[model samples]
Target chain A: MKNQAYRMALLYDFYGEMLTDRQKEFYDLYYNEDLSLTEIAENYHMSRQGVRDAIVRAEAVLTELEDKTGLIRRFQERQKELRQLQELASAAQAANADPVVGDYLRRIQGLCEQLKQE
Target chain B: MKNQAYRMALLYDFYGEMLTDRQKEFYDLYYNEDLSLTEIAENYHMSRQGVRDAIVRAEAVLTELEDKTGLIRRFQERQKELRQLQELASAAQAANADPVVGDYLRRIQGLCEQLKQE
Candidate 1:
């Protein structure tokens, strides 16, 4: 479930704008806010089925965009590299006896963290 | 002109899918393929003015998507960071007197180059 949520969050971050306003709102409430379809329907005066349909369609749109562009996949791959670089930096920092080189490794570690956010 | 082409390429890579098929073809021919507007129109049975209009509208769509998403901008910033990381690694390697630390810094430098390609 956590992995599914992470993938959904990344996909939504990349392509959720392609979804309609209502789709966006419902998706946010459903996925990010963890709202039930019935709860969301009641809150928005929508049929539960209607809310379900909207959220499913929105997910489809996000998935289609991701399938075509692979932006999210590319981002995840980049993140993996950043994490590896972070690991290497930590290892290098530990091995390095030079204070100045250690400082540089520390900077590289910080940069990896920042780029992961990107 | 070089800067414009770079920005256009980045924008097109990010959001060109939102454009129509004809618009994509025309944009590729004009900006990437270096075809003149008249040449594109002649090849595609479009009026030169019509081709220009299609291309312009397509450019607008690309630009608007960039404005809203800023994916291209984020990528450019990340590229900038990667370049700086590369420079820092090189400098740190030079400043370090230890052979093992230098080897570590070289690996970090290589990692920076790889991430930049990402």
Candidate 2:
């Protein structure tokens, strides 16, 4: 659906607690539950504008934290590097690597994949 | 000094930007530079308690971010696992692995050590 969930997951995973508890509640409903802003406003008994302001402020906090820390960016970068390394291992194995050694390279490629999931 | 710098470097590297500009400045001197709190307070022209509060709050933010995301912890865990995998590679090499395969295992060990430093 190309929803914001993927980005939200990245941002919220990194800095969700930066939001106030109240803000987090609304954020979960809006992003995680895919609830409409008006639905959230109705449920929370707040003005739509008030609900939106809280969400907007929360989103800003998430974005600002990301810009400042760059943790998520670095993480994604490391993942990219790991995948590249796996490819390199495959190349190394193909380049006249001994069969036993080729086995070791395959194991390493597996490890790199494991690291990426972490 | 077994001081907070090592811890700070990890925290800052992971989530330093969550701090206010003022908080980051003070945190650098206190943790990164190992300045006494009194010195920091004097330099910043703030009350001692004010300086302390700022640093404490900043530390809390870093710690909380780590706890919630588990990114740093997961990072450390991966490093550990990589090292262990390297050991497994060595074992594979020792158990009658071809000489060329042994070289690959050695190279993988080196890579694991490199990853730990990151």
Candidate 3:
């Protein structure tokens, strides 16, 4: 499940980068807005296959972009690392001998919070 | 760049949902592992276009999955909303009459931190 979430997150990031404006509209309608492909076709005044092709092309672009870049992959790795750090911090807090661990956790937490704000 | 990040994230998530084990291996080598299609084909003992088709089909699957689910899109939207909220809280804190805004920011910060751990 975690792997699935990470993959979806990366694909989402890649598609946004590589899709053209029309493709983005269709993608948003189909995925973000949960519109059917048939509905997207009607709204865009295109045939079902046409919409399908656009989506396909957009997907290829997204995949190619990911093949060239590792941004999302890196982000997922960082998130995993952050989780490990948080867990360590929690464990230390439970031990009650190292408030410094909690401080580190809080600092990492602040960085994550800033990332969300970005 | 932000939009690119979001798109890539979604595509990654979608691809993770739909790929088979073989496809996953190839995809990891090609994208996350930064191997070329030709290289992957050589490694997998497949024809060049066969590798191409696999990647293409995988891309289609990823796109279809995204079309059906909006997990990454929702995450991006939430991140954007959080940023806006953070900005609002920061501005309120600057106004000097509402330390409550600072507390709210800290609380939201904490939630974001927890999300990272997850």
Candidate 4:
């Protein structure tokens, strides 16, 4: 199921770009529509295993995309940076001699907070 | 390296919970602050390999956290769902006369777009 989860993660990353039209449809149905594998099979008029294979293959492609392009990886990196920046700003605020630094930190903190909410 | 990337991804996901305070500092420096591994080693007052091990071990812990808790995985899942819902809504719009479905789809699409921008 690691393979499934990895694929799902990859597909999630490049849902806009990677999938062929039919694969995208099946992917949307299975994952986004919350259709059961059986339901997908019935809807697509394919065997359960066939539907499963498509999902699996699509997931592999997605994972490959992530490995090569690092879109999701970079997004995750930014999040870490924002959190650290917030902490640094708080530290500066505590130091109290650097109001300018504090102010900058606060602004960054606010932006990060907004991003987290999103 | 895949291991490094995997570790970074994991650390990003559970940056809140798993890392010790010192480990967090080092991770932020290397990843968030974009410090070189050598710089991190110098700052930490350790051998380069020691610093590298700390980072490697820390990354392993983060990956382990993803495996166990799956917070990042779930977030990715939600994003996929929103995209699929948007596509369905567009399809329904093209078909027409399903105002209730269309409205629901539009609402979901709006929320998803908001989430992605975040």
List the candidates' TM-scores in order: 0.90, 0.76, 0.44, 0.42
Q: Write the per-residue lDDT of candidate 1 for residues A1-118, one digit (tens) a residue.
A: 2247777887888777777899999989988899888899999998999998988888788887777667788888898888888877887787788888778888878878888888
Error of 3 at B11 (Å): 1.7
Worst 10-residue lDDT window, candidate 3 chain B = B92-101
Worst 10 residues of 1 chain A by lDDT: A1-10
Instruction: Give the runs in model 4 whose Cα sits over 4 Å from its true position.
Output: A1-7, A97-102, A114-118, B1-118
Ranking by DockQ: 1, 2, 3, 4
**Considering only N, C-alpha and C atoms within 3 Å, which residue pairs clash in candidate 1?**
none
Higher-lDDT candidate of 1 and 4 = 1
Candidate lDDT (C-alpha), each: 0.82, 0.77, 0.58, 0.59
Q: Per-residue CA lDDT of candidate 1, range B2-85, in tens?
A: 247877888888777777898899889999889898898899888999988988898888887777667888888999999878
Q: How accurate is candidate 2 locally (lDDT)?
A: 0.77
lDDT of 3 by residue, A1-118 (tens): 1234345445766457445689778766766676777898898788998988887777676666566444466556645644553454344334433344334335544544555333
Per-residue lDDT of candidate 2, residues B1-118 (tens digit): 1257688789888888677899899888887787888899898788989988888898888888887777788888987877867776676566533555455556666766666766
Clashes of 4: 0
Q: Is candidate 2 or candidate 3 better by lDDT?
A: 2
Question: Global CA lDDT of candidate 1, please?
Answer: 0.82
Residue B104 C-alpha lDDT in model 3: 40
Q: Candidate 3 residues B36-75, lDDT tens each?
A: 8889889889997888787667767776656754445656
